[model samples]
Target: MLRESPYPMVSVSEATALIMAHVQPLRSEEIDALTALGRVLASDVVSPEDIPDVPKSAMDGYALRAADGLAPRRIVGELTAGGTATVAIAPGEATRIMTGAPMPIGADAMIPVELTEERDGMLYIQRELKPGDYVHSVGQDVRRGQMVLAAGTALGAAEIGLLATLGITRIAAYRQPRVAVLATGDEVVEPGSERPGGAVRDSNRYALMAAIREAGCIPISLGIARDDIDVQRQAILQGLDQADVLITSGGVSMGTRDLIKPLLAELGTVHFGRIAFKPGKPTTFATIGDKLVFGLPGYPVSSLVSFEVFVRPALRALQGDATPFRPQIEVTLAEPVRPSPDRPEYQRIIVRYQEGRLLAVTTGSQSSSRLLSLRGANGLLLVPAGETTYPAGSTLPALLTGQLLL
Candidate 1:
């Protein structure tokens, strides 16, 4: 059983409930068959009829009745995948059928043509065929009215092929979540645009955009949001109007210029003010009607870290993905790390395999501003608050950050 957090800081479980309460299901859209890969099925798909629609051949050998397996069979007609054979096989007669060809009536098994020699209108069987040998029974792949896919199963190539077996040419899939991303704060600037003095290149927007796309959603860039309330309000509304999720960076901190929290409160109800996670403690999540809004910290590291912890899950839920977050594994600590009593820490650390064991080692610093350290790291050392003085070789839960895919 999971333990309830004792810290007044809203525990991860509580924070998750607060985050999910604001998001609503996205509308559905019909995408082309080829484009359905990685998309989620909006509803359960049941096979209208038996898959294969008929008993078909799984091999190229021969087709015959399973009861005729007792003696040598007669090959009177041949059938391929696209062609149909009208001549019915008698009690001891076998029809030649290639792979994917539907079996004729009274035929129970398929016999390979290579096993029989044919002369004139008669086929001579060289070996005795077994019962139910080559006949792919009707409904072997899928039965009529059988549930082929659950509502939440995201579509993939294999899934598409399975659906095709049921003659499904078109599918109903969950609409992609329209995520709006904005990099706010006067100090922030776009990556490609000309940079003015004192403006830092906007990495959060690009990183967040990539992350959103990886989650199979549509992401829009609202550029940079200035410190003005009206400007912030307009920007927030633009995201609220279209997107199911609105994500912004650089305005939830304690600085006098920070205006996201107050403006969001005025525009809509703020879901949660902050979380216990480090480097992202100032994060804020709110709802503008049905739109879920996340105000992330200005630092690139904090934005990425918090996204993994919060926004990623929200978007995944919107997409109907079964496994929303990155899979976690237990590893031994390569070095000891300290956590503050006030906040839980997600420290970027490198994990290396040594002597067939996973060992995690953190960089010299875990400050939010250190971009190089975070880039060099491959995993996170998750230490809860007030749990300081961990000795080397201790076991802890770590999130893999390198060489991983959703």
Candidate 2:
């Protein structure tokens, strides 16, 4: 049996703004650069020293003066990588240098070994050489005192390699948030457990945990709490104590047994009780002290969609990520579809490139309980509330959730 709720619903934008208004970035922590992948940089990283501080050879060739081009020169010395030139080269003199080797003094250019032939300790050039040819000048890659990475930048493989090149083994990065997941309702049972009549498997907890991990946050499971107010209260208090954010499923709706919203009011300030969004209308947000709490719907799809629309961005913001929202792109609908009558809907769709055009096809059945609707879905097509139907070839903006198919 459903019951009426006294809380007023807020628009999606209003709810998002309200949630972000309270979010604060976590403090920075010193971590090894090798382990900083996917972590947000806390401060700008400046190059302490120029990359390739000294002029080096860019190829395995003979280093010689360009003025002596096409002139048979005697090989004065051979320099390998990490080896320094002990002697300077004069006119009619050359040094056999390997790739990445420091250029010999007075040597202004390099001629590839393939382009020349060596005989009787003399090197002959097949092609004309010019000054600065095949030579990596000082600070060619990066200059000293230059900003290499800006604050709030997410570290990736290339960033880590750059850090190593700059001799930065340690870095200051924003700490990843720890999220606590709590499953409620007496009808929920653990997976792989024998279910009695009227019992359903607890997929929401596992799904939410996976989503939390995918967002680069730690997930702590608080097990299950029955509809009992006391049990739910204790679990919620424990979650708030152990995690930076608390997520509870199955107790935010307008029902007689929906005690999470009321308990959140007693424990903290409920910023917004509901949102005017489909698949997650009963979503709730609150703040208890410094910790955040999100009450999501019980359905599997609703739980995941709510996480994508709200919790994910909050997690990214807590890590100081500059762009906390998903990338949005314009997509053309491949087929006609009816829009929701009231609140806006985020329809899951599979996006692909066909004939040089990006087209989207809706997944069958947008029901909140059907988790399969999200399978193979790469974008969420935003359908506005209207009585008219959207015809085929209608263009709309969609939030990209994954890579597009070719």
Candidate 3:
């Protein structure tokens, strides 16, 4: 029988719910539209006026009245893009218009240059043209008073272009959260430090920093914090002072060097200290004033999984993302695997599309310390508790970590 943990344990769903309940979207900031990529909009962007504002030509062709006879017509003055049409097309007359140019008066259609031949200053229509042919009507794309971009929409390249079309130089979006990453433990040293008798390089903090950046949060490194209680306390306070969210990797589990849990309880309310999940059962969450703090495992893979499961969603929620959680899908197991007895498991797996089905293949070893298991992994096989062995062809839900090869 396994020894009972002193800290109360909760399910993953409960832990996530509690964390999300305490999260509030960050305050909005006005940034230039060009720099708003990947930012969630705080307010709906309404169109001030019609895009294009007037009827424009969709092609470089002749703008002439469709009622004009098929006989040759005199080529009047030319109209280029962005220039107003000063000449009107009367009977037996056509205006050479370029793409995006406003249609000349008395012209209801455009005949593409390829469909007509021009010789001796006269144009002959070789194809039948109908009214309103090849003409982009005013407000065809967007109308005044329309919502160009809805609130909570993450701005991307297409959104930026649309905002530019709407004459929006700047946009109001939720501010990105600043995450402070602190590595703790007496045996842990900086990455460049020489490996003495019994010291391990601090890789968790650097990995957490990159993970925070990937989640769209600004990462602030708090360096390494020794296992001493006083040092850990001071580091936590400093991290809180400079960051909106503090992520400490190490010193949360039941061990002689674990000082983060007790220190957090003394400093702030530790909401929940344990979860019924493999690889990251000792994950802890707390709130110091308005800032959120996450205590993750020291093992590299555990830290990565904990951040992806808890911290990442919280960060996205702070940025007003509508879909904060990673997408989940059902996939078939390509091989047999044993499940974690009373706790759920997040086994990293490489997903492939085979015969129109998603196949899940486990990454080499599931050890929490093996960060390489996450390399090239795009999905996590979510094996629930209460099952021993799952054979191939068994269906289970999986959460996406990256792009799946489908």
**Among all candidates shown, the one with the greatest lDDT:** 2
Candidate 2: tens digits of C-alpha lDDT, residues 196-281? 99999999999999989888899999999999999999999999999999999998887789999999999999999888898899
| Local accuracy of candidate 1 as per-residue lDDT tens digits, 176-266 | 8989998788888778889998889999999899989988889999988888989999998998887878999888877778889898889
Error of 3 at 313 (Å): 0.7
Model 3 lDDT tens row, 1-406: 6666567899999999999999999999999987788999999999999867878899998998887758788999899996755888898899899999998888889889999999999999887778889999889999999998888888889999998888899889999999999999888988888988888899999989998888888999999988899998999999999999999998888887889989989998899999999889999999989989999998999999999999999999999988899999999999997898888999999999889999999998999989899999998889988767999999999999899897
Better of 2 and 3 by TM-score: 2
TM-score of each: 0.82, 0.96, 0.93
Candidates in descending TM-score order: 2, 3, 1
lDDT of model number 1: 0.79
**Model 2 residue 72 CA deviation in Å:** 2.9
Clashing pairs in 2: none
Candidate 2: deviation at residue 272, Å? Answer: 1.1
What pairs collide in candidate 3? none
